[model samples]
Target: MEYYEVLENFGQLALACVLGGMIGYERQSRRKSAGLRTNILVCLGSCLIMMMSYEIYKQVEGMTNADPARLGAQVVSGIGFLGAGAIMKEGVSVTGLTTAACLWVVACVGLAVGAGFYIEAIMTTILVVIVVGVLSHFELKKSTRAGVLQLTVYSDNNPEQLSIITSCLDDLHIDITKIKMREEYARNEREQTIILVMEMMLLNSRHYSTTHIVNILQDLPGIHGIELR
Candidate 1:
């Protein structure tokens, strides 16, 4: 009701908008599904709800039953719906987890601002920006160094090809995690086939070329066919 109090409330809302906008800007730059306006609305809505909670508390200040934080607390769990909307699942890869997290944290930042926890809100905003902008690329580069390798080799049931394959991987310092082998036979064809499903950790080193590995495997005696997936 008071002019100063109105200014204070608007200030919190403005801070929430600015902080949420920063997060949304980063996601927008990355072309994410939940960007800009979505995040700003989420933060602004949360801040408004928090301010309403405080107002309700003031109205019931003389009553012993008043709990200012009761309404604001719901915002924490209620934000999950928005967070879930930002997430996506695709086969083996799940994307948009970070975007979902950003939404959740921005909501928290908004609540903090509305509740007059300015320091916490500002620090959280800075950290969110750093995580979204800087650490994301670092994690991506690290992920490129690790993967699974599925290899199927056709040989004359001889162990030589297997030996060369293991030797090549060992020399290249590649880590072998798990391997499964199964034998397949064609009724119309005379030669039997050995199918190898190997899970390997690939290093992003110059010496490790998949093409070179395939060529070396092909050169082995009695190797009828080679496939890598």
Candidate 2:
């Protein structure tokens, strides 16, 4: 490659680093699993692959049928596996989907940089940052309004008590995401008590409030206390 060509490639790589790092920093600040280094590597690798593809096409130019996009197309499809690794399932809640998507988009941005689409790459980076950073606050606010309820319930060690609580939640149309139970011996009362911690989300159609949940549960027999978080 000519000296000028080498410098151009270097510039593209540097731009990829900056653009990818912008998104990565946001993810890192949010404590996401795919952050900083991961994003940078994905972007830089994709950029290099695209550049190689272009160079190969140039070298083989009239000698054979060469597609500069062939390698980039592979990168687009192959990146899915890396993105899939970022996703996680916990109980009924799935997390890291956004991180996975971020990885995929960052790879595309890198390809754009490598293809000399500097304007497009920079614009994409800005839009992605806004979506993941500024727009996330709105998403959070909406989620808070929708209400994911965490409740700690203390009750006598009776299976029926647990059943009743679950049934009540079902009746209220609460979508229970997770439940954890542990038995503890009450030193003073000389009886075994069950501590149930529940994480649930209230359906949008349901109008039940936290206070209503507490009141309903408190009236149930064998229930000692209910705490909401």
Candidate 3:
């Protein structure tokens, strides 16, 4: 390798490291999973891979059969698995989607820096820090008002009570997406105790707490029992 080429490659590696550190620091300060060391290693690894590819390209006068975008594109697709691993679903609530997205962005930043797109990498890193570290709190605050409610009702004597209950829920402006009964058993009888389960998607879901709903149903004419899960 020529002396100047070696120096230029070293400069690319150094700058990639420094920029990665800057972004990682911001995320680490917030105690994110993909913090300093993780980002640093990613940046270093991408730099090495690109440097190798650049050398191969140089050998062919920048006319190699191998594509420059090959490795970078793979990095993006592979990073999706990491992002999916980060996201978690728990009983009508999902978490870590944004964190997972941040991790993906980190990989992109590393690739950009490795490919000598310093300005774009640095700008994207700053935006990512702001998006993940700064904006997350507000998004969380906004989401505090969001919640999900599940309900099941049993009635024995009054068959018409089903309409009443549904109407009441409608009056409350609650959105009901699905209503199913006899899903657990083969029998459907009007005189027999019937189960009514409501699957609802709600926003600003604080208006009716599950406990509060239970309390309200206690005195209703035909209510047998209520379950929330």
Once fitted onto the true fold, the runs of candidate 3 whose alpha carbons sit more than 4 angstroms away are 62-64, 140-229
Question: Of the candidates numbered 2 and 3, which has the greater TM-score value?
Answer: 2
- Residues 1-229, candidate 3: write the lDDT tens digits: 6999889888888887887787778768877777787777777777677667666666766454667777777877887887787677643446667667776777777788778888998898788777767787886665555555666666543457657776766666665544554322224554433344433333334477767666766567766667765
TM-score of model 1 (CA atoms): 0.68
Question: How do the predictions measure up, each by TM-score?
Answer: 0.68, 0.76, 0.61
lDDT of 1 by residue, 1-229 (tens): 7999889988999999998899999999999998999889888988988889998998889898889888878998999987898787642235688898898898888888888998999899999999889997886676565544456666665545456666777776664443444455644267544543323334434455677766776786666677775
Each candidate's clash count: 0, 0, 0
Model 3 poorest 10 in a row by lDDT: 177-186
Model 2, global lDDT: 0.83
Off by over 4 Å in 2: 145-148, 152-197, 201-208, 215-227
Worst 10 residues of 1 by lDDT: 195-204
What are the lDDT scores of the predictions, listed in order? Answer: 0.76, 0.83, 0.68
Model 1 Cα RMSD, 1 decimal: 7.2
Question: Highest lDDT among the candidates is held by which one?
Answer: 2
**What's the lDDT of the predicted structure labeled candidate 1?**
0.76
lDDT of 3 at 69: 72
